[model samples]
Target: METLRNWSSLCGYFVFIFLTTVSKDACFSEGSACEAPTSPECFTKNAIETVYNCEWSMNRTDGIVTFDLYFNSKTKFEVFNKTWHTIPEEKLIQRREVFIWVEAHVGNSSCSSPRRSVVLRDIVKYDAPQITSMSWSNSSLSLMWEAPEKHPALTEVWLRGDGHPAELRKETFTRINTDQVTVANLSQHSTHWVQIRQRSTQVKSPLWSNWSPWVKVPAELAHAPEVNVTTKRLNGTREVTLTWKLRSHAAAAAAGVTYQLSDTQSSLGCPCARTEKRRHYLF
Candidate 1:
């Protein structure tokens, strides 16, 4: 019985040492508020540099808390002897996952150590482009834009055109590593709407930016004659004479032009009918 009691005591001592060693290495206790760094939010990349900030907290008031930073499962450093540390740009650009933990030491007590681990997954993202200039000539439209602030290399741009007359032809342009694009074969004398968006192919799981605001190109200039109208009235009767003079100097000289005159009240109420009634006029 004595030998059995001694063996039992020796086993209990070994168990206590094992538990203490485990606690010393990783001391996170139950109910302790330890938060891991969040992905994307914890990592930021800009044109100049990429940075990572590791943050965590502990509930124990009697212990000193320190942090360990890791990248790709490799220990990088112990948070400069602090609870939070910022990984430099050089280290941040190499890895996608960041692991951090808090280590707390409470006085000389046996259960004084605690640890909590946090893992963050992040991907680098590129900025969105902005349209800079637009020009139109004949049936071709040209667009120019500035590249995104970050990850500008190997970018793909999408240009979309929306036109009037519902049945009007639609045009789309897709290009890589280019900042300017010209689209042709657009209908003459019709309004066209255009928008552009871009994404970078530099990283896995690339993110596409939101589409830019719509831009409008007004109806193309007509190559037809200009007309001046004059009205005359006789003093004795409800009779009027209207005369129109056509000027064919600039645009009309190259193309044949014809004109038609119609009374507003008889044909349609007003010029507003051209749009509201979908009236088609030939010149």
Candidate 2:
């Protein structure tokens, strides 16, 4: 049987599962969690610069392998040490993955301790992109929005509030960079609260953006549009031309204009109203 040997290392990042949760605890158990090297000790950790020394451990019965480390700490807490000694640490790291560096001597004569390094990285997290724009049809809504910026990968987006967690009953989208999207098969006259989360391609972990503002659809029957506005213009002598179509009337209203023109009405109406600025009016 080939025994475990030569496990390499990596580094760089904000500590994620390994540091904040796993690696930190692993290192702490060895550093100060225990009483002494020969006996046992539990390592303590801090927020920043809480790197841990590593070693290996093996199951006595089956020879399953593991590693450990130790640290010197000073504390009145009866659990922490004030020093950072690592000489007795060697007895700790015979079989485990280590993040902190310790010294190694070559021979018994005239030797300097060399530091060892462990390679570990933080897993990245991200949130889902929001739906910027949405429009409704009979039983569906046409959606459009900007894609999420700077994420490893988008895993899934879901429409919520319509069913249970398992019976979400909405189509799933995994596309990125396609701002304009379509969501079909919706009930009419009801609101849909959507929540989404993404994952990094590097590791199989989920990162979710904030939930978008809610959107509603008709859960029952629907109505059609009366008219779609396509153009508008202000003509001479209190005349406003409003042109819209998809129905019959393609021409302006017969009145040619409609208004109760007045300058003495109120000075407080609009102080910033603009007129005759390239066939445009602003107020």
* Top candidate when judged by lDDT against the true structure: 1
Error at 279, model 2, angstroms: 16
lDDT of 2 by residue, 40-108 (tens): 222312112133322222212222212222222211111112223323223333234433422211122
Task: Please count the clashing residue pairs in each candidate, in the order shown.
Answer: 5, 48
Model 1: per-residue lDDT, tens digit, 4-50?
22224644652222222332343344554433322222333333445
| Residue clash pairs of candidate 1 | 27-113, 27-114, 27-115, 28-114, 28-115
Query: What CA root-mean-square deviation does each model show from the true structure?
Result: 16.8, 20.2
User: Model 2 clash tally?
Assistant: 48
Return the lDDT, model 2, position 59.
17
